[model samples]
Target chain A: MEVDRTDGRTPNQLRPLACSRRILHRAHGSASWSQGDTKVLVAVYGPKAGTKKNENPEKACIEVVWKPKTGQIGKPEREFEMILKRTLQSICVLTVNPNTTTSVIVQVVHDDGALLPCAINAACAALVDAGIPMKHLAVAIFCCLAESGYVILDPTKLEEQKMKAFVYLVFPNSILSVLPEVSSTMKGEPMEHGIITSVTHGAMSENDYFLCLERGRAASAKLSDFLRRSLQSKVPGDSSKAG
Target chain B: MLMEAKPSTSPATFVDKIVVPGDVVLDLSTFTNETIKLGGGLRQDRDAISVMKAGKLKFSKPNKYWVESSQRRYVPCMEETVLGIVVDCKADNFLVDIKGPAIAFLPVLAFEGGTRRNIPKFEVGALVYVRVVKANPGMNPELSCTDAYGKAGEFGLLKDGYMFETSTGLSRMLLSSPTCPLLEELGKQLSFEIAVGLNGRVWVNADSPSTVVVVSNAIMNSESLSGVQQKIMVEKLLQRIK
Candidate 1:
């Protein structure tokens, strides 16, 4: 089956993105994001001591809370918590800030189709707002292979349910150094792994698998650009400041 | 270090009106050879005079033009009382919803120095008076509910006043009249406070009897203050020579 992808968007096209940091007051760091009609607000608290005995350790711990549209929590929220914790841990340099905890609270004030990936982006923005150090940003993207042979990038809710399989990818970007300048730092080699973390759910054909990766990579690049721009705008004096 | 220069553009447009990734329509007849400045509205493309793509715009409006755009920051100043509800409590601090991007925290220590036990005794949902102490860009704002006269003691609570939603611009315009004698006539001082949060929540408490009457009339009429109407109403309210 063929899908009509209108709006002149490529199979891996991302919606127009707008992000503003320090959007909320009480939290240590906060950001508000909008992609098309999907809007999400994320607040980051802590680096403070964790109250959970078991979870508290010498290293910083990450906590994710998802508040849905109905203003209630459910299975989806639980799953998001797990996914976010795992994804954030991969990029967060927790060892650097021991005994501190980073809490990421995501509120989906509005929903369109691609919420999970949007939430992930918002979370990353919040993390930056919170001033937490990270090896790299864990950018995410959603892709699906429709029943008909079309590969969809950043699939909306309706498109997701109609697809045969879905994939979520969280990756990082880093500058590779040509040589090891210090004994502590690893030198040379493809230095920048910029490894892509992908999770595929449901069954799909081999062709769909390759297509999903291809679309995922393209979407990731677009999101990375947006993340960079958002961070740049919030920095102390990059000229975006209002005099 | 290489610094990126901001492009020289004319000011005749509002930032919100500029469409992203879209073209703009310009009228060259009104355009001059010299660089024109655009504030918060539209601009014309010089080349074609007839059409121009939207130009790069600033995110927030400058303070000179207090137009209540979504991107403006909320700041509190002296003598301007604010109305806010306590949303959360943390030891000596109370998180009050002042209708901004972040809840403004009121420290119990800012209150009048007293020996009252149970120091920071403020309950959730309790409305209180607060004055903006300092609004630091990189730090959470500091607020005090007490002023020289007293601890905002009872002046902050709203007993018989009406509550309604309005924009920040309208609220600012209403409060611009510092000494509204009309408000004092009804046996109440024009010593009311209001908070216009960025999140669209408006909290107001008017102590002036005439001011209360004006507020009631505005609410009953479902009238929003803007342009001429707002100016006229504010002028009339400040005309009381008592």
Candidate 2:
């Protein structure tokens, strides 16, 4: 087995995580989350009155503004914003804040391999901090298919560049442990884990994609555990109790 | 939907209930000649008064209804005093970013007893305490440095203070009647000068910078806390500082 992973971890291991909520005093809700060396700060504003231009009066609207680590916003940041907006819009209970706009401003402090997933996690944490109602919490993990067909979970930026294909997968908080038969949701049966959004950066076969999905979903339990513990700690007087 | 006659909502009951857009707040037909005025966060749709935003529904005495919420962006409203930072200085107006959607305009001659030769020169990035004079839709909000009697009235440049931004709700809480318990407690223990603007900007100054930091941190930590919680929190903070 070729041990090429930097920061010295197994293929499925995640980096050390530290996230703090309400870091920005001015924002309605804010959080700074870092996975390994990759860090992102997210500030959520609004749940206020009215939307920006092309206003939608029916359901709540979400706008994501992504600012890169350096340089002005360009096409890549715009694409990230679109992807994040869609993922957050799915999890957030929009009908709760109708005709209002909640803007999530994400500033990239550092970009390792899993930048998007970290941004999504930070945004979700910020939304929760803002007291926004969400159907379920979402967590993202980046999976890479190495040249040797080994799937690496939560790859760093350097690891991603060395990969054959990279897949970014997001999954809503779900019950762990789906049976092997149920794991392959070929019959449209409601599986324990549902993919909220999936984006592949390089070419990979359908089998490889599904393999990456399986590995990514299994590794998500650790991320979910981190989120639950962090959120519980933030809520005062609700000190970590059995859930 | 047919406009069936429904009982008007009690203003007292709706004072603090969170409301969403399109929620029919009051059925005007049942009011029966009793005049009621709608405030911000509400709009008239046909015979029913509906909410236009998501916030706690607020109602004042003598028939006034509005929604109250703490948001990052400040919607310009007439007569509200705000602290603004000058973004640019033009011949006629100074562009100020009051954390509003549109940049507010502070006219050069809007100061008290102003004349052509006496126009106050404010450098870019200067912080000024001003009142919203005009907030027409599709136009920039106009700001002034004078009160109703054309006096400066404690509205002017704030200097040598640590200015920090908070949510509009937190700032409102700091300025509420009877004073916020946190501010009251801080004032009792420490001698410091503080200014809270409706635009959510706060300036704190003291003989020592440490006091300013402690006061600002105490206030920021008290945003989601209750009155009693704020007092307890401030006590703990003060204890740590000592």
Candidate 3:
């Protein structure tokens, strides 16, 4: 049975978000991000000289630690940690801080929905505040497939529990100029081509996935705009320079 | 004890310009006959002086060059006075958080004319103004409350002020030149006591609590403002209080 979402936002609408950078006094880079009821604070440290023996010397290692608000980190939080690291790895220009570790600590303030996306957004802002070089900024969105095969973007945690499956799609802030909008299923749509990482939960058909990707890409422009504005305020003089 | 700097091959055009890592700031081939001193954020490679960090290239006349940027972590430098919080204490050293990569060790005996019988007590969380005595890589920084002649000289416990944090760049700006315009403008209207730490902590005290609040807010807001903008901001803040 299909039911209306409690918030009354359209299925394609994302929760409203607010972000602030450099919040922590001691951390090299920090940001507090909130989307609707879910809030996450991320602190990025290092590019300073510390690395373990097995790490590669030519590139910086990205470490993500997730802390729940009340209890020890359980398995779900651990999975989110790995997902965030992999997503961030694709965009961060790790070669700039060779032989060092950039640790990103994500603390969950509240979780109503789209926790991982909020965490990813916060981490990206914190990394920028820390001045880590990056190829592009990545934004994440959680979309769910209802029982009727209708897909919804930015579902709340409660909605997630009732949905059959969900997909986490991460899109880069800008599509590479190299891959303009050529019409091909495998490689073209600017939105589809710019995806850095995609994680699927439950069974999603190819059509459902593409539909979700379309919604996510459209939603991502808003997130990217918000991030760029906040970033401009933090580091004046250059808006295009991400390094 | 270094001598005067040698002439440059060709004048470097990077002063006050933002530079990124790997950007060459100077061509050693031009100034091969003269000695140039490279400071932090700059590395001397064969025939090239390159930036090691992203920041504005800051060149001090005659020969020193470094990069300046707003940073949260403090890399300890000798003789730089900073504000620190007491985190822990041992018989000989008190661990202080100077917002550095590691905790600094403030020797209990390094205070003004100190002896074992009269050890000053700094309970955990007490704030102190101290100078960096030693800052070697791979070693914990060392701090002292006394100057070269062993006098406190404004380096001691800071009390009864509202302590807030700003970027290290803003804190440095607050201590720079004839005076920061923001501070200058505020002084004309009200009286306040301020101790700025290079590590980004600022303690402000005034005759009334409202004055402290106004001054701190104005300073924080002035971080990204120009001198003229800062003056306007201070005026607006002062007007609100009036």
Candidate number of the best DockQ: 3
Tens digits of lDDT, candidate 2, B169-199: 8899999999889999999999999888998
Predicted chain B of candidate 1, TM-score versus the true chain B: 0.48
- Residue A11 Cα positional deviation in candidate 2, in Å, after optimal superposition: 34
Report every candidate's CA lDDT. Answer: 0.56, 0.78, 0.78
- Residue B19 shift from truth in candidate 1, angstroms: 29
Off by over 4 Å in 1: A6-8, A174-196, A234-243, B1-242
Query: Candidate 3, which segments miss by more than 4 Å at Cα?
Result: A1-27, A30-43, A46-62, A66-101, A105-128, A131-243, B1-11
Candidates 1 and 3, the one with greater DockQ: 3
Task: Please tell me which model should have the higher TM-score, number 2 or number 3.
Answer: 3
Could you give candidate 3's per-residue lDDT for residues B92-142 as a string of tens digits?
999999977668999999998899999999999999999999987556789
Which candidate leads the pack in TM-score? 3
lDDT of 1 by residue, B81-129 (tens): 5667789889778888665434677876667764346465777888765
TM-score of every candidate: 0.47, 0.57, 0.61
B-chain TM-scores per prediction: 0.48, 0.93, 0.93
Q: Candidate order by DockQ, highest to lowest? A: 3, 2, 1
Model 1's i-RMS, to one decimal, reads 16.3
Q: Which ten residues in a row have the lowest lDDT in candidate 2 chain A?
A: A234-243
